[model samples]
Target: MAQKNYSGVNISVDEEGYMTDSSQWTKEIAKEMAKEEGLNLTEEHIKLLEFIREKVLSGSALTIRAIGKSGFTDIKGFYQLFPGAPLKKATKYAGVSKPSTCV
Candidate 1:
């Protein structure tokens, strides 16, 4: 799989299986990704991802657990947003860290 370079603020694929993108997985990108994932882009999805990213970026990485308290009613809300897009890869796309997978 191709990886993203996180050494800078731009999204880049690395020569090796490494990702170096910062992880900012904002609401906008997540919405687009969800749309591509066959999910309907709804306020619920946006709200969920935004909530997830906010919590995740402010401190520790967010596992599914952290998102439970957010007003989604189900994991479907998260999938509709993030959809297993890979936090590391999304972060890389956001230029936060190197990504080990593609989002």
Candidate 2:
């Protein structure tokens, strides 16, 4: 696997898999990926997107349940956005998890 930068979006593949740029990844792409992961992009997806985008903008991380609690109602759909993401590190990447949350 190799790291790729698409339109300034950085990403890497861990397998013999091909890597794609997060920059090229649009809401539509996310929607499709969510569907493939068994998610229905209802308001939950929209909220997740908003949270992720916000974290990205603020240099932070976002969590499935936290974002869900923010306004979304579908935990299942939130998980679909990142089916393979580890539970703990999910917010670490977005830098959304604060010291308080960890404790």
Error of 2 at 87 (Å): 5.9
Query: lDDT at 3 for candidate 2?
Result: 65
lDDT of 1 at 94: 37
* TM-score between candidate 1 and the true structure: 0.46
CA shift of 6, model 1, Å: 18
Once fitted onto the true fold, the runs of candidate 2 whose alpha carbons sit more than 4 angstroms away are 2-20, 63-103
Alpha-carbon runs more than 4 Å astray in model 1: 1-27, 75-103
Q: What's the C-alpha lDDT at position 24 in model 1?
A: 35
Worst 10 residues of 2 by lDDT: 90-99
- Displacement of the residue 77 alpha carbon in candidate 2, Å: 9.7
lDDT of each: 0.45, 0.46
